[model samples]
Target: MAILKHVAGKSADYGAALDYLKYEHDEVLKKPLLDANGNWVLRRDILLDGINCEPELFDVECEMLNAQYHKNQNYDEIKTHHYLISFDPADKDECGLTGERAQAIGMEYVKTNFPGHQALVCTHMDGHNGSGNIHVHIVINSLRKLDVPQKSFMERPIDCKAGYKHHLTKDYLKHLQQSLMNICMRENLNQVDLLSPSVNKITQQEYYARQRGQINLDKLNAELIAEGFTPMRTKFQTEKDKLRDSITAAAKRAKSFEEFSRQLQAESGISVKDHRGRFSYLLPNREKYISARTLGTSFDRNHLLMLFESNALTAEREKQQWSVADPIAVLYIKSNLRLVVNLQDCVKAQQSRAYAQKVKISNLQQMANTIVYIQQHGYDSYDELKKARDELSAKMSDARNTAKSTDADLKRLNEQIHYLGQYLSTKATYKEFLQANNKKIYRSEHQEEIAKYEEAAQFLKRSSPDGTIPTMKDLRAEKEKLLSTRAVQYESYAYFKDYYHELQTACQNVDMILDTGHTQQHSRTHPKRSHEPSL
Candidate 1:
């Protein structure tokens, strides 16, 4: 899951933002790490770029812009707004989210959302806490450097103009979160509903506290080991950690708000309170209640209500299911709600002669039900019949269009896989030739391999300009998935086509029946339908 966070800097020093992006900061000391040479140490790996300003001269440019616009003079003014996009670590393996690809995506996001700002777009392969989650840090000067076109995320008219400072709004943040979700989906990366609160939100202070406490505990255990004494506990849990665990365990089992509160109090000695439609918990020793925001969104009032409702529904469904089945036998879940045991249960559907001539149904009874069905669907009138036919035709067209798109995707993927296989097959000799003492002689000796490799290389370059090559495993899996999807599309297309033809045939039969009924009304050979299907 990708998470977005915004932090505003209050410092007047414009250079510090760029410095932070370039250097590794020690969270324990709250300062940048310095080498023996008395200079800030560069981070392990990063992809840094500038937006509307030179990255190396970012501080100078921001200062000059501030002087020009007469902004950020006050000590309390926010100098920069830092936005972080942290991606799920699993994305590296699942979605092939390399640092280069993530950085490119970050750059595109910055260009589209923060075009007018002097920004630093930086990506780190290893996250701040060494979680190995690829993340991007975008630090932009609070002041806008150029006029930008109005966007959906923009709130006020002044938001478009140059020299105006950036302002964060609820609407803007929601838009950013939604937009990030879209990008993740487009790239086939892992993502979540970021607009909703996190299930477990550990603030920076809590995270660091846990880290420090664990380190101290490990040291204490080491001393005990040296003294040849057993250490009872190896793990350290903060108060909030204990609170979160207790709440989570209780919330999962409790079916209602009252039950959840009672369980929490009984098991953990934590009192749960619902105040003004929000939920909070008071730890045993704590004087104040910890707000749901601190614990996570899962413990909030709305989410709790939803969870309770789900539990109720599940219990109801199980009870009804058990009532209808043998207690010792496990029953299959329902796909269709209606269960029919006899024809009489479906009167109109059972086929009773009133509809025989109305359509080319199997029997007189079926014919009777066919006309009943037509009347029930409001297709007895000419206009309604014509409308149904038109709608079915449109649906048939849609099926065809969708199938075409799926086919095109499958074709392109197959082509790319073929090119990839060829490239991999001839890669060894080509690489050896490149690294040879005399490359010209090596290339001549391996002419066939070089030629084949070059042909494959050219095709692959055109296919993926970003040098994105899916692993053979990934490609094979994708091919299997697309094949299954193609089969489903084929089935859908066939179903729609058959339905379209059947409807057309029924309409023709109905027209013929109407003409005969009009011509023979005076003959007294047949009586009108006594009962019609209730609409």
Candidate 2:
């Protein structure tokens, strides 16, 4: 994918930034190539139109412009703005774009977007870690040298002579991104949709850590194996991954922003801080925080607000429906409260009109009788209803755990059976491999087969004290035995599945009974009195 990386930084000394780009010193290099003092290697360097300087005189020309036109005399003040525009590395050979062609694209980009600025648009061939991605460095003097056309900055007319400074905004950045995409498309080069929804944006810190092979779990597992210790499952999920999954799940389940935020904190132990208009998630253990946009598009500030608005509209419509809904219809919906909470169930319920009608008919008759029973016995208090729901939820949780455990056992057993079968099938190949061990020559095609059998044999030896290799007949018998046991185990596990469904239905029934035709309020003061009817 063609990633448009935009890094903007102000520097008092423009030459330093220019030198860093041209010098080619990075962690990937075995030795820093800074021996050449002033003469740095550059693939292509060109000054834009109106910049009266050759590529060779880049430093002197920029210094002169800063000294003459720039009003701020302070040496520390930012006199130059640097930007990076890059493309995917594979584009070079794939798109047939030479270094000169890439430079032309960069030059055109600067001329089109950053007009009226004395800019040195330089294209570099050696990317980070020798990735070979052709990237452009657009170093422009902050002081404008010509009248920027109204088309470039539509908000206000730029008069370079009147000391008007160039301004960049989010919208302008997006516009420039679009222009780059267009340029790539027009020139028949490799391109990516820069405007696509950015779900996961990896930061520089994570990128460098991965490059350095500093991630712990992977290294730990390899070390454990090397030391003859069986490596257990490594909990490799970082705090960020957990937080992202939690937020994404909550966002999907929550009906409103308030509910999403509340559920996210309650479930994930991550507190949300909304300062000014930006949103950030603060991890409990870490002082560092991540922005909402950094998480994904679904968690963006604007998107969350839009979701809140949408949910509010939905609630309003539901409230209106509740006011005039038929008693049977209300009862039917109340009986399916579990469906309301489960997106998958709700989708299944809406899959077909006939199935939905069938559900309604079933709920209506049962609910009609339940409503009569509730009227005769008086309503169940909020606390009583909540207790019943909680009890059912507990049962469902236990049942789900049991099912998951059984499924895991089945999977492990199946994997073992498969490995044993493979080992038995490759016995002949293993004998051949043993003979080839001392031989000077062996067939290359048989190496893969030999390796697989060898790995299985070693694993089997580690598992068994005598290193017993099961015969094909024995392996088949064991597999058949496991299949038979699985059938019986599955039959037993069917009860938990049924139990979960029954508990969900019961919980939904209780919610239906409590939520309909009642204004129940909850309070901490006088528990019994608090549960009294609000109607």
Candidate 3:
């Protein structure tokens, strides 16, 4: 995950920011909250507010602030924070930990390492990355207590040190790193060093310039051309002939060292040996040997010379151009369409299972109620009641299976939807390519197909008797209805089952109680006869 740090306030020093960032790291309960772009965005401001509030008052005050912000902005208040450390979720594993959990872990780590400082940790999950990564945001409060003296906020604050102005210094950054390292060591987590921030160091142009200087494009093109081969610029290719022409032109322009060699090999069947004992196509009548630098490429003569001597260039080029017009593109498009289909299938499966679960739960509830009614009528020991209890138990097991199957179907449906989303995103370019090639035909076909599938999927999305996808409240109502039905069935089964067991236990107890009472009565009536016993 990529980690980013930003400082707030015009006069903010690195030290103060670092201290605040560290404190925020410790105080926030969840890590890496996702933003609209699906990147992890953590705010330091909310963390600082959380830390400054009394422990008992933190949650309530935060909730009120959040509520007020939402009422005004319709979004979370944390987005308004001045300082933030954002993380990219593409770098993380699929543990499904939410932003809250990330914040909690980060905060706990900081609290254990740094004693008195207050911090807010925000964690986020971002789906924007090619590989989803989880990121954490740690925000710390820069200002220390005004009344506190001598001791830095890094140490435990005494009762007398309630209102001191604590300023963060550059040295505090060092302390922050040490604390983070300590936590990492204790927890066996990966350690990162932010002492020298890498983001602000270089410009993109400078990096590109350096990269361009390392490649000898001119020499490579010439060599390929001389071997009766052409350099194809796959990026701009529209047709096969165009690709062939582009390669032919580069071969004919044999002015540089590489180009001359390439042309000579194409024209004359001559091969020559270099100083390094590498074989290259030699000039027909020229006595002097040409080095790669004569072509003005920026590599060492030996390295440039090696290209002509090697056969691996063709293989590498082929690999690079593999996806330019391959069948894989078509296959990917088909796969994406299949995914859309699968999602429809899943929705249907989930709907069917949900209905089945509702029915089974209802049946179980009814059976439970029936058993309870029988026991209540003083027919507790009836043989028919025992048989009904056993039958109901068997039915209940079937209902449980139905519920489990419904959960599985729902999970599958969700997974299919997620996969379809990913497939659409990844193959977006291919779809565009197809449209560009056959605009009217492809559009008409895709539009019709998509419309049909959407209609079918919509049916499964319905959550009410009106055949509409229900809102949260509507869904809840449906759930309650099913649950209420199930509850009644369960009550009947439980009542009868419990009654049957109770009767058996009572019968045994009664037999013992009567025997003891009879013996006691006999003893009272005739003491000698009681001892002698009437066989």
Candidate 4:
């Protein structure tokens, strides 16, 4: 936020100019007051003869004032004034005002803070986006006699460059800032520290970067290294080749070290080890090559190890348990889930837009109907009816544009949904690898048995008339069917076959218990027994 102030007008027309200035910008028009003539007056001055107003430049003052204020007003009766005042838009809200709201607020401030005198506080927007900034043009009526002695303008020549000397001063600006700060505090808005000038100046990019969590971890590591410490890398790769590939991939992704480390662990099972032997995983074994420093930036093995060690200690203190689940599998599932959710949200937003557009079209149609009815009934003159028809047509055009925008939004949403669905299907194949690595059963020994049980369950679920519980007869039939359909091998499949039946029975029992009032505790303690004779 920045502030710029200017003053224009002689004492006689200062009141009118101030009044007109109030109408210039939306924010300043709302200010409470514009004068410093009363008891609450912060400061005032009447330079009179000492105040130099070049008669030749008086026209310039009128022109400037008219350009900002009276251009749209009845100019014949409006008197122009030359008053000096400093202005800044950033402090608009601090004065308990903003946009159109500031106009009233500014007027009140002038009346209460500087009574008897008149002034105008105007506000404006600047930059690419319309960020409102307000500056006040406090024009005091010079004709109004002041109880205080006028300043000797001869002793101190009027500095036209310094607008403050003509009327407002540096102290006045400080007072205004203080007043605005108080208002801000009362309103629970952010208040700039007047003691620190730097607090008032921040670029838009800096503000946005801070909001988006754009951290400079490299700088942090450098500072630490300067203190005789090395930053560690906790991410691991499957092999030296994989590690090299990850480094290359990370550079291509342009991801931060932390983000890359997380991505690697999600894509690959290999975890990086630190000096203390703590570990974090890296991405998969890809053929890509990346630079070492670029991959982990300022992080090295030692620093990573230290971090891992610290985390391990914390986990130990908390009695945290590690899962056998592959980090990559979990990451894949989570990433896919996020994609799905994002796509869903986008779809919903598009639907909402479509609904809004439909409503707008309906409203426009109603307006058109009303206009048609008026024309048919001869309720209005031809010109009036024509105007009404034209307005309705314009509304219809706007509605069409809105519909087109909604269509585009819907198309984008559908594309995202399709992409997410495809990604999910591709990732589903990886579930087999995940189950093989983490499940209690060995795929080599139990894959066929598990598949049989899954098939039987699906068949029962689909074929059962009333979805009744599987009976002993049903289980025996399923077992017999499996034994007869499959060719006998040298190794007996009976053990695994029996185990699969037991698991299915247990699942059915659990489901039955869950339907009843029996708790999971009881179900866990009462697993189904195998009907087969003991080996």
Candidate 5:
């Protein structure tokens, strides 16, 4: 995936910016980013739109312009904008995109986007942490040094004068993202959702801390074990991870952004703050806040708003609600829905063997109970236990059969629903499918649409064995029934399986008692009788 990051720097000395750009940073590369020839690799550098300056003299040109025109502007005002456009590491081999191609893309991007600006474009082969992704660094002077012609949208030309600073608007940033997305798509390179936030994003400090913490933890664990102490480790949870979870939980429960913010504060004690057109989260204990944009794409203010707004407006109302028929089944239904293991079942499994060892009943009582249980039916010793096990197994087999049937029914229903949904969704194209005079011409024009509709029709025909296609309402109703049946059958299957396993375990215990020396004890007790009647 491609990542676009912008870092704006300001300094009275333009040389500082140039030095920072050219010099090797310990974070970015272990050694200086060298070319294939092994000299200091500034070979990929290109100076754009500067007549008097080469790549090396680009900083001097910027300084000269600043001294001439923007002398009154604050020394601390942003004089340089550094942009990092990194491609997917795999794209180099997969898409055959070279460092030179990346450099060209960067140059063209700057030329098209920041016209009349003096910019230094350089491509680096090494990424931070040996990532090996081809990334470009474009450092453009804040001042527009050439006159830019006014577009049709503008009323007047923009002249290069004192304080002719470029405005980095939100739209401009969005345009950069869109441009990057288009470039990747055109090259058939792997691309990420440019508009979406990444799931896991850590700061440089957190990244280094995590790396160090892992090493320290391992060392500490070893030392603790040597001292015969309990080895413990601290789990690191960043503010972003905490906020992401809190926000997601809040989103599920809250309808609106206002409610989401309130719920988030209630849940995690992090209050939402929007100041000067930026979204930040205020930690309860911290005076300074961190930007939401820094956290990840999903936590961005606009994205969050869109998500919560959609939930409030449409999704929440459209969601289906299912109910358990039996009150006790509610627990099972919830366990299934959450995909959580049953704690009671886990505890029972752990304590199962203890049942054999800890039984307080005397042998006499056990014998009496076993005799009574056997007497209720025609049962004898091992045969009785085996018979009981077989009955339980049979019931389990039946339950499993029902469950399998339910699954098949659900699968068919789902496929029907999917095809029906596709047909409904692509109705506009299907209309064109029907209206086409020349079939070949229509297929050529609306190839994708025609293919989608044809696939759906074929599936529908195959599914409708009775030669009547199912209506959406009919399919929906059938789906609801199948889902309901699936839940019931699944629960029954679990219950029968557990019961059968208990029977199996009990039978195995009985077998252990019968096969061990306990059986010899009975034989020894009846030694006086040469022949004993089988019970």
Candidate 6:
């Protein structure tokens, strides 16, 4: 997955932007991480170069352009725009990604998307955090030196004109992100949903702050411990972190905006408000409110409403279930779904010595539900209950496996169909290149299209074991049939999954109650048995 990030530079000295890229920085101290030679240190697999300017004179060229364009002359104006494209660390081992290849992709990316700009493109193997992710840094001078041809994504007339600063509009940023995703897909590299909002969008500043905060907290904890004082907190949480936790916990059980707000206040004193369809959280004793976007996507209005809708549906389902039967106590199994419990034949399990340790006030509710479940299902013995659970589990597994297999096949067919289209689109270009007298020169002229055609052809050949390629029409027909099959398979899977969960919970609750009750009975009958050992 290639994650894209942008940071604008306001310093008038263009050299500062270049320095940060070329050198290493101690992130915590905001100073250069240097070597004995007094030069900035960096990873060994570093690839660096400048585009549309002399490598050494990149700053001079930018200064000359700025003077000529008479733009970005203000003291606090953005002098440069830095775009970072960080690829998945796993790609190095799984997909054989290297700094050199990543650099090439970065070059192609900048050339195609950011034309007519003096840009510096560089790649790093083990950046700041030393995560081993191959990331590219592309920093461009704010002023456009050459007029570019109008493109579909360009929004304004001055966008294509010289002397205009590079515009980082939301649309433009999205375009860049999509381009990265496309590149990842074409290259067979792991990719993420780059277009969607991040759930927890922690910036570099916040990330470092958390690290420093934790270190400070640990130090304070050690000092307090040495003085025979118990520290109140073992973990440190930033305000944003606290807010995220409070909002998520409140949202988990909240079914509406009003309920969510009340829960937030009652649980954590964080009052949430709706301002023009956006949710903002006001932390206790804080003057300013933090917007939902700053916290992450899951807290946004749309996501929260979707969560509430799901919660409402669950509530209705539970209501209907109870209306048809007794008040079934909720038996949480990871997911907080309400479940009816009853699998009462656990006499054999009650003999275990560990039962006494597990009993609590909650066991009473569980025991009642277990008895009701057994009576409703007519499970006469522990054997009968076990048999039912095992049978349902088998059915659930079969349906789940079938659905998963169908889904995988659909993905394969979709990728093949896309590859087939690519091959067809560029077949003419490949043919023309083959027939040309000067093969090398023609290949050079249409390198991109030819490369794409070959890549698609190879993939198609590998996919088709029988060497029989299906036409697009046939592929589409097959895909449709598979889609229909998948729908049916998923329906069965869903039904079995729900049934199995309820039955499984009933079995567990029954066993728990029997152990607790039987252990207590044995204790009353023979009080000294626990302390008395067999001779």
lDDT (10s digit) by residue, model 4, range 475-514: 4434433433332320123323333333233333333334
How much lDDT does each candidate structure score?
0.78, 0.61, 0.41, 0.39, 0.66, 0.80
Flag clash pairs in model 2.
Answer: none
In candidate 1 the C-alpha lDDT for residue 529 amounts to 59
lDDT of each residue in 1-535, candidate 1, tens digit only: 8889888888877788888888889765558998999988998789999999999989899889999989998889998998999999999998899999988988989888887999989998867677889999999999999998998788898888999999888888888899899999999999888887778888877877887898899998896567443464578889988888888887786789898888777667789889898888899898988998887887788888888778878988987887576321222222211111222244454464354223223434444544765675556686677676677688678878988898998898888889888879998898787679998899889999889888877776666645444556456656665876788888767766766665565565566556546646744765545573331
Candidate 3 wrong stretches, greater than 4 Å = 1-4, 10-49, 54-91, 94-101, 109-119, 127-131, 145-161, 196-535
Candidate 6 segments exceeding 4 Å error: 36-39, 225-235, 312-535
Q: Where does the lowest 10-residue lDDT sum fall in candidate 6?
A: 327-336
How high is the lDDT of residue 415 in model 6?
A: 99
What local lDDT does model 6 show for residue 386? 78
Residue-level lDDT tens digits of model 3 in 390-479: 554554565565556555545545544443444334345434534477767655756654444444334434422343332332233334
Quote the lDDT for 136 in model 3.
Answer: 54
Off by over 4 Å in 2: 27-51, 70-72, 147-154, 159-163, 202-242, 245-263, 273-280, 285-290, 301-535
State the displacement of the C-alpha of residue 515, model 3, in Å, after optimal TM-score superposition.
Answer: 99
Model 5 agreement with the true structure over 423-461: per-residue lDDT tens digits = 667767866666678868877888887788768867786
RMSD per model, one decimal: 24.2, 19.9, 35.0, 35.2, 26.3, 26.4
Among the numbered candidates, top TM-score falls to 6
> Which structure is stronger by lDDT: 3 or 4?
3
Q: What is the lDDT ranking, best to worst?
A: 6, 1, 5, 2, 3, 4
lDDT, residue 206, candidate 1: 83
